[model samples]
Target: MSETIRLPHKPDAPLSYQFVPGQGPLSTTHLIVYLNGLIAPQSGWRATIDHLRRRWDEGGSRSANHPALLTYDRYGQGGSARDPADDQHGGSHDIREVVADLHVLAQEIRRTKMIKDADASNEDDGAAAADQVPKPKLIFVANSIGCVIGRFYAQTYPGSTAALLFLDSNIANSDQVSLFPDPDAPGFDPHVLLPPDSTVADLRRTRAGYAAHFHPSAPNPEHLDRRNIISLLPLSDGPPLRGAEPDEGTGPRITVVGHDWATFAEEGLRGSMNVPEGLTNRYVNPPWAAYNEGLARLTSADRARGPVIATGCGHFIQKDDPALVAELTDDLLRNIEADSAA
Candidate 1:
């Protein structure tokens, strides 16, 4: 069954979420909270949640248990809270708020009572059914900037999460080559990465260029930056990129990797749009250093184990290859189950 509800947050700051409860193994539920990339709320992948819910059912066949999952639109991106008025440059510059909202939302869901079986007179069976209801553990799945939010959440609320599945996501502190910082300067470039500080006419022109080069239909072109650069690409035209596959054997905490860089030409296109030339050199030369440090800190012990390159797909791996996303989701749940058993 599916239902939409608003989370009790700031009166103006409402969150939108879709709930899909899994059948079969009542005791084992997979609670997946996805932090979508930069795509608009009404886009293809947003609609693809229906398919993901169905895939959860398909994956249940192999499971030693059952699962339930939920997906929510983050504030500013979907039907959730609007961007804060103070942050005109970017309402959500501080991602910790997003993490806090997620935590609160999870607590709300856990507190709600599951519907009683129609036949309440089942006696002992009802007791078993009540006991079987899984105490949901959150599995945060995010891409691009969403990964940054997820990273902070894991670090802040270490024990609350069951596992994390970063799909083509930016690892916290990996030495991966990134267009985020300048190679020569080795730091973030405000002008190149963020919109250049210029006149309205010039900003419009830059925004147009971003729309043309980035995603043809960007809601707010001025919002483009190193953080969300990957989320804007359209998925309709890209070649099929192999995605992260499911593994029944592994535990829930996992990092499934994929890239939308396709070939050097595509990389150049992406480079032209957001990354500074210096950062590009750093990205290509060392290939890992520029992006690995934060990723390393976010992951520790058994939780930190992936850089599984998904070739052919660009930054929007979920849209580029939904199959991979579905596979990774399944694998993550399994891995979490395995970890609990250990």
Candidate 2:
């Protein structure tokens, strides 16, 4: 079921969120939260969610009792209202503010689940049984810009987070403007990144939408400076996994899935774009891979699972291959379970 939850600080506006309850015992419940990319709505995850739910149902009794899914629209996108006037970022899409919102959402989910568990326990086994329920394990599944929010959240509240799944995530350092030819430079066509079927009208609409929600004070997406994206980077110091013990093979798991840049180039490069092939092959691809690799290193010193390059996919890995995503998520859950058991 879906509902709107008014932020305690901002009573005037509420965030739109949907929750799919698991079919298992409350003690072993797994909470999977989906974070969407910039400007993308929760509705964009419909296909992927459907596939995941089907997989969950097929797992029989063992899978049926755990792993609930939750997804929400960010402020100013989809059904969620715009940020309140008093917001620190003045309604702009600030990563910090987004992280704060996620923290609040996570807390509320825990609170709601606790209440539900208490009520069930009291009704079935008396009031004394209420205290026996274990807290739900949290797993985040984030895509594109959403990865920034997920990484920050995991760092800020690692004790509560069980794992993170990054899907074609963007790297803050990979946005260097110097790496690509200037769109305004003579003979450097701005339409290089545009799809073959896209018209000028489509480009205009896209630009308009970008200007509307993102902070005007910040650089545009194409010209974003490194400082603007520094917060999105994984913490160098690493997150605090409170109860995790390396000897037991249990700790927060980090999985990174990136698009195969070579495959992207094969499909994206086309007539008269004027972008140098060497620029993409030499300058872009290497750094892109390095960034993904760096993220894996930052998240896990042992590199439990190295960065995965999705061969047949583009930037939107989930959409390109929903089954792959579902499979990976299932693997992650099973790994978490095995670790916990150990």
lDDT of each: 0.50, 0.63
lDDT top scorer: 2
Please report how far candidate 2 places residue 336 from its true position, in Å: 1.2
In terms of TM-score, the best-performing candidate is 2
Clashes of 2: 1
Model 1 spans with C-alpha error above 4 angstroms:
1-4, 24-30, 40-64, 83-93, 113-135, 171-252, 260-304
RMSD of each: 9.8, 6.2
Candidate 2 deviant stretches above 4 angstroms: 25-29, 60-62, 85-88, 91-93, 121-135, 181-227, 231-251, 270-278, 301-303
Model 2, 96-147: lDDT tens per residue? 6677777777667656764465555565555434345455667888897777
